[model samples]
Target: MRWSNWADTSSVCGIEVAEPAATAEVSALLREASEHGRRVRPIGAGHSFSAVARPVDLAVDLRRLCGVRVIADGGGRVRVGAGIVLGDLNAALAAHGLALPNLGDIDRQRLAGALATGTHGTGGRLHGLASAVTGLTLVTPDGQIHATAPGDGLFEAARISLGALGVVTEVELATVPAFRLRAEEGPEPLDAVLADVDAFVASADHAEFFWFPHTRVASTRRNHRVDDGGGRPLPRWQSHLSDHLLGNRAYELVNRVGAARPGWVPALNRLSAATLGRRTYTDASAQVFCSERSVRFAESEYALPRAAVVPALRDLRAWFDRTRAAVTFPLEVRFLAADDVWLSGAQGRATAYVACHQHVRGGFADVFAAFETIMAAYDGRPHWGKLHTVDAARLAELHPHFEDFLAVRERCDPARVLTNPHLERILGP
Candidate 1:
C-alpha cells in the first residue's frame, strides 16, 4: 500500500496497514506487532507536512475508533475518540452546546494528530489544543492499556509525544460553552503591525496576521468572543465566494503563476496584499476559527519568545531584500500563552508562532533554511509537525522537560514500537 501526507511532503510505500475499530482491537494489534517484532505507527488524518505520520512497518488506522461521548452535561467535558477530525468534533461539540476553547485555522487534522504535534490556535491568553487534554487512553507496545489523567506520570509527556510513547486511542477534553466570535480582518502597514504586534495579540480573544513576502502590507485578523445569539454570519454566497472561490481556487492559480515567473512575485505579492480589504462578520466560534484550505504547500513554523517576533520579522525582511527570494505564500503569525505540556513549542514562555510557506511547485529549500536560521537566534522551538532540521540533541537543549518526557516514553514503550524515522530523529531511539 502507499500513503502520503496532505502536503505531499512525505510518503511511504509497501507498508502493512491495519484498521482498528476499538481500543481492544488496537491493543490486540499492538500485541501482535510486538510479538512479531514489527513496528507499529498510528496513522491519523495525515495533515502534518512533516514525516511524523509516515508509516514504516504497520500503519494502524484509527478512523474506525471515532465518536464523541459526553462525560458531563452542559459542556464541561467529553471523551472523544482520537481519530475524530477536528471539523467533525467541532460540529459534535456544537450539538451539545460545547466547544474546544481554541482551534487552528485548518480543521482537517485528527484529534490525536493535532494534540500529538502540539497544534495550536492564535491568542496570547490561550494554550494549544493539547492543553485541553485532561485525560488519555494509551495502548503500549506490549498490549498494556493505561488510562491516564493529570497527576499521572505519563499524562503530560503523552500529550505531545509525537507518537513516540504509544497509541492514543481516546482523549478526555475539558470543553467550554459554545460561543460566537465577531471577526474583524483588514490590511495594515506591515511595519506598523509589527511595531505593536504584542499589543495586537493581547487586544482580542484571538488574533493573527499574514504578511506576503516582498510586500509592505499585512492582513490582520482579530476575533472577539460574543454571546451565542449575537452573531451575524456572512451570507452563504459571499462566504463561498471569499473563502472558496478566491481564497483557495484563485490563490492556487496565483501561486502557480508566481512559480512560473519568479520575477513577478513581488508585484503579485503586492497585489495579493492590497486585495485583502477590510471585512467584519460574526459567526459560531468554530466557523470563525477554522477556514477552508485547499491549496497545498509545505510549511516551516517556529515558536519564539513573544518579544523576539518583531526583530525576527525585521531580520526576515532583511533576508528577503538581500536575496530577493520569490516566495509566493504569506507568512502567518500567531500567538500563544505559555503551556506546561512537556513537548509543546510554547512550554515555558509566551510565544509568537511564525510560519513560512512555499508552494510545492516553487523552490523552498533556501527560504525555509534562512527562516530557520533567523529563528534559531531567539531559541525558537520548531513545530513538530512542520519541516525542520532540528534533531533530538538540539531539541533537548530547547525543551527544559525534554529528558523528562523521554523518561515517560521509556516507561510506556521501552522497545519503541510507536515510532517512525521522524520520531527517532526528533525524540531519539
Candidate 2:
C-alpha cells in the first residue's frame, strides 16, 4: 500500500485505501477517519507536482466518485463530484455545449484536485480554473457537510486551499458555451520574440511560448477566439499526430537523448527549437489548451512580475551558457492577470509564469535552484502544486492575506485533520 506521486518521485509513506463511489460514501469515510484521528487525504488522479495528496496514514482515491449534476439553468453551471476527471468533464460539457472557461497544460486532474491547487492556463483576459468554480461542497473534519458559494468567506479560501482546509467532495463550476479557438503555433528567435514580448502578449487572446535553453530559438503559440461558423474538427488522425506523435513521442525521444548525453544538449535544443513548425487548428478551447504529456518529468514553476520575464529569461540563458546544467526541456512562459485568492501565484499583480522541467532521470537540483534563485530576486510566488523550498513564514511575506487564509482554514477545519506532512512544511503546524 505504498503511495507514489504522479511523477513516482515520492513513495516513502502511506497506503491507498478504497475509493468512495459517491458523496455519501466520502462523507462516511471522512467521519470514520476523524473518529480514529487518522489523516485522510483525497487523491484525484495524482497529477499534482506537489505532495498535496500524500498522506502518511490513508489516501482516498476519488476517481470512482465522479459525474456531472445539473445545478442551475441547463446552461449555467454543473456540480461535479471531486473525482470527475477533466477529460470526463470536457466530454460531458461538450454534450451540453458548455465548458469550464480555462484549463491548464493537461486535463487529467479531477475537478476538486484541480480547484484545490488553482491550476491555470495562460490568458491575460481570463482567470484560473479555480475562478470558474461557483460553489463547493466539502466534508469538514467534524463530518459536517458545508456547501459554499460566491458570497461566503469560505468560498474564496476553500477554492484554492491546496487540500489543506478540508476534503472537497464536490465542486460547482460556472461553465461557458463550448467555443472554438483558432490555434497558431510557430517558432521565433528568443531575442527577437522578447523584444516585443509585451506587444506579443497583448496581441493574442491567449499566448504562450517555450524557449529552448542554450539556444536562441523559441516556439510561440497563440489561440484566438473564432466565430462559431462550422469546420470539421481536426481529423482524429491529425490530432493524434499533433498531440501524441510530435508533442509527446518525438519530444520524449529528443529529451531522452539529451539527458543521456549532457554534452549534446545545445545541439539537441537547437534542433528542438527548429523542429517547431507552424500549424493551425480550430477546436474547443480546452482541447487546444491540453497536449499529451506522456514523457515522465518533474516540474518547478514560479510567478514573477510580468515585466521581469525578459530579464529572467536572459539571466537563465546566461547561467545555462556558463554552467554544466544541460537541460533539454524547453522553458515555458505564460501570462496571468491578478487574482485575489490568498496563495494564488497571480495574486495582486499581473504575472509571468516561468516553468522548467527535467527528464525524470535527469537530476534537477542545480538547475531548479538556479531558477529559484533568480525568481526569488524578483519576488516570485511559487505555484502551489509545483516544487519549492519556501515555508509559511517566507510565504506569509509574499501573500498579503496569508494570516486571513489560515484563520479561515482554522474555522473550517479546527482539528487540521486534512493537513499532511507537506502541509506542515508549507502551512506549518
Candidate 3:
C-alpha cells in the first residue's frame, strides 16, 4: 500500500502495514521483526510535513490502540493511547472536565506524533505538549515493554525522541481543569506589534500573530482564560462563514490566483489582510485554540530565542521586499516558555516560533531556503515535524543534550531498527 503524509510532501509505496490493536500484539510484531532483522517504523496520523514517519520496511499503524483512560477520579491525570488524535483527546478530556494546558492551532495529529515532534502552542508562560507528559509506555525495537516516568533518565529523551528511542504506545499526561478562553482577534498595525513584540506576547495568556507579505497589517489573536459560564461565542452562521468560507474556501481561491499570476501576489495579500476584521468571542479552550485548517500548504518553522523574533521578522520582510517573492500564505509567529525535554525545540530557552508557508501548488524552494538562512543567524532550532535542512552535526551544537539523547537511543534500539533516512540525517547513523 502507499502511504503519504497529511501535507502530501512525503510518501512511500509498496510497504507492508501492521495494525496491532493491543500492546501485546505490538510487542509480538516488533519481536518478530527484530529477530528477522527487518526495519520497522510506527505510524500515527501521518500529519508531519517531514519524512520522519516514512516507513522503510514495515509500517505499524496504531489507530486501533486509541481511547482515554482516567488514572484517577479527580487526579487530573489521563493515560491516553498513542493512536488517539489530539482533537479526540481534547473532546474526551473536556467530557471529563479536564484539558491539556496548551495545544497547537491544528489538532489532527495523533497523540504520539505530537508528543514525539515536540508540538507546541503560543504562550510565553507555557511549555510544549511534551512537557505535559508525566509518564510513557514504550515498546522498544527488541520488543521490551518499559514504563518510564520522570527521573528515569530515559523519560526526558523519550518525550521528544522523534520515534527513535522506541514506539510510544501510551502517554500519561498531567491535565488541567476544563477552562474557557476569551479570544480577542483582529487586524493590527504590523509596525507597532513588532516594535514591542515582547510586551505584546506578555500581555495575554496566549497570543500569536500572522503577517501577510507586502502588507503592513498583522492579524493578531490574544486568548485569555475566562469563567466557563456566561461566556459569549460567535453565532453558528458567523463561525461557519469565518472558519470555512473565508478561512479555507476563499483562501484557497486566492492562492490559486496567486499561483497563476505571481505578479499580483502583493495586491492579493493586501486584500487578504484587509479582510481580517475585528472579532471577540469566548469558547471552550480547545475550540478557541484550534481552528479548521482545510487549505493545503507546505510549511517550515523554526524556534529562535524570544528576543530574536523582531529582528528575524525584519530580515524576512526585507528579503520579501528585495526578492519580490510572491508568497500568498501569511507568516505565523508564536511564543513558548523554556522547557527541559531533551530534544524539544524550545528546550532550555524561551522561544519565538516563526512559521513560513506556501500553497502546495506554489514555488517554495527559494522562499524556504531564504527563510532558513535568515533563521540560521539566530541559532534557530528547526521543528522536527517541519521541513528543514539541518543535520546531526549542526543539531548537536543546537541541542545541549543531543549526545545524551543519542545514548538513550543507542540503548533502546541497539540494532537501529526504528531509524530511517530522515532520522539518520538529523540524529546521525
Task: Name the runs in model 3 displaced over 4 angstroms.
Answer: none
lDDT of each: 0.91, 0.82, 0.92
Instruction: Indicate which candidate wins on lDDT.
Output: 3
Candidate 2 residues 106-221, lDDT tens each? 98888888878778899877778887777888777677788887877888888898887777888888888888888888988888889988888887888899988888877999
Clashing pairs in 3: none
User: Against the hidden reference, what TM-scores do the models get?
Assistant: 0.98, 0.96, 0.99
Error of 3 at 12 (Å): 0.8
Q: In candidate 3, what are the lDDT values of residues 173-236, reduced to their tens digit?
A: 9999999999999999999999999899998999999999998999999999986586688999
Against the true structure, candidate 2 reaches a TM-score of 0.96
All candidates: CA RMSD in angstroms?
A: 1.1, 1.7, 0.9
Clash pairs, model 1 backbone? none
lDDT, candidate 1, 80-163, per-residue tens? 999998999999999988899999988998999899899999999999999999999999888889999898779888899788
Q: Candidate 3 — what's its lDDT?
A: 0.92
The predicted structure with the larger TM-score, 2 or 3, is 3
Ranked candidates (lDDT, high to low): 3, 1, 2
